[model samples]
Target: MTTDPQILVQAICTLACYSYLIKENFAYRIAEYTLVALYTSYQITRLFHSFIKPYWQNYAIGEKQYYFILMGALGLLLYTRYAPPQYRWLARYPIALSVGWGLGGAIARSPRPVFTQLMDVMRPLNTANNVLFFVFFMAVMSYFFFTTGKESKFIQGSGRLGRYIMMIGFGTAFGNTVQGRISLFLNRLSFLLTDWLGISI
Candidate 1:
């Protein structure tokens, strides 16, 4: 019953998307394509305003940091992907540069996460939960000792416990993911019922 244009359009799009659950049709396709097109255009506009414009004005032109122009040109080379067959190879230089830079950055930053987890695991065993965590951590670490001989019963028992702990951790993660998705579904359903239909619920 809402008269607001934005809310009405949102409700219509939501229904169009949910219609696919019943059966795919032109309405669902229209909604899906519209969402993709809108999202793409929004991202392009945001990139231009947030990054390209500022970089050009501040670095390339104003501050005489002309190297930014070369960077921009390199980025432009990525579009050579759509060029004719013979000319498409020009895109690989930019692609290769990007890959190398990304890999180097990732490698440099990767140790931070490992160190963070290690620090967390090295917490004081002052509480029951902390003690439990330390024991579970050791068990899991023992399970990965591929070089160690499995003749000892202690290692076998620890590894078996580690496997069950891992299963529980995985199940918890999966349940959290499902809960997040259901939360989104509930929000959309609430919008349809309360905002669109003007219901009190």
Candidate 2:
């Protein structure tokens, strides 16, 4: 069976992206830039259609004129970065507002997942897997605490335990990395053999 035109185009783009593994050349760079440009254009279109146009046309023009004014002020403030050195400090107004709003939003949403979950994990009395999890947690935490003199027997013992725990983590991570690389290699090999050379997998 023949592939669709859209599938053929996608396959060509994928091959171009995979070409980077062989060497950095025009094909890879072109594909990379093309993908980025397409994504950026799509995002700009989405922002205008979904946010700016709808909000301005429906809400801001009617009962929310104040929002339009605020948006204009914020937009002008963002442009202050292009001003002369003497006026460049004006950019801080928009920057500060953006950061403050972002921080508030993040903090409002963070506590339940971050603090509550941490507290729940630390509360060994209420935990179902308390023994195993607490031992693992303490072993990992001990790896970073060096206040106890390294020369002391107790400190040396804890340090050895921590070292083993860390080694195990590192070993697992390394194994995962190798597996991922092998998978990537296999994918490229499949593309080269099956697509370009027309060999059946």
Candidate 3:
């Protein structure tokens, strides 16, 4: 077994986390809460070093850009949600500002990506794959023909093909997600065996 203190601690934490797979117990709860607390502290430290310290040193005080202080105050107002019920309304301004800013940014940024996707889908049908994709795309799009009558046989056929293509796409995506999770699990297992136990696999 590895005697390094850091490695030992990590091994213990890993075992504590894995214990949850068997049944929820004190060790699992401790591991869960410890991870959360550590992550929260780490994020706060990073925020201070990355944003708060730099903002204060460069913009707020150094450059005499005192308007930055208002931005800081606006961010702080988000915490007022935890205040007394009457004072909680103070959080609404920041919340609304954040939502509006995010919405506007998203609207501004969406067009380029949508246009790019449309361009990609309009690729030349020179290759077999491109031709197949074009057909699939049209069939899938036809599935959304809400105004088309059920008596339209062509539309019905295309819509049914679209549904099957969608099902296959969904299944493939789900399989990839499961494979990724399993990969993570295998990596952790390898770490336990090779790093903690000092086993040559």
Best by lDDT: 3
lDDT of 2 at 52: 84
The runs of at least 3 residues in candidate 3 whose Cα sits more than 4 Å from the true structure, single-residue gaps closed, are 149-151
Global lDDT of each candidate: 0.93, 0.78, 0.94
Score every model by TM-score. 0.87, 0.74, 0.91
Mark the regions of model 2 whose C-alpha exceeds 4 Å error after superposition: 1-3, 122-129, 149-156, 170-201
Which lDDT tens digits does candidate 1 get at residues 28-72? Answer: 999989989999999999999999999899989999998898988
lDDT of 3 at 42: 100
* Selected candidate, larger TM-score, 1 vs 2: 1
- Ranked by TM-score from best down, the candidates are 3, 1, 2
Tens digit per residue, CA lDDT, model 3, 79-191 = 99889999899898988989999999999997998899989999898999999999999999999997893879999999999999999999999999999999999998999
Q: List the residue pairs that clash in candidate 3.
A: none
lDDT of 3: 0.94
RMSD (Å) per prediction:
2.2, 3.9, 1.7
* lDDT assessment of candidate 1: 0.93
After TM-score superposition, the amount by which residue 86's alpha carbon in candidate 3 deviates from its true location, in angstroms, is 2.7
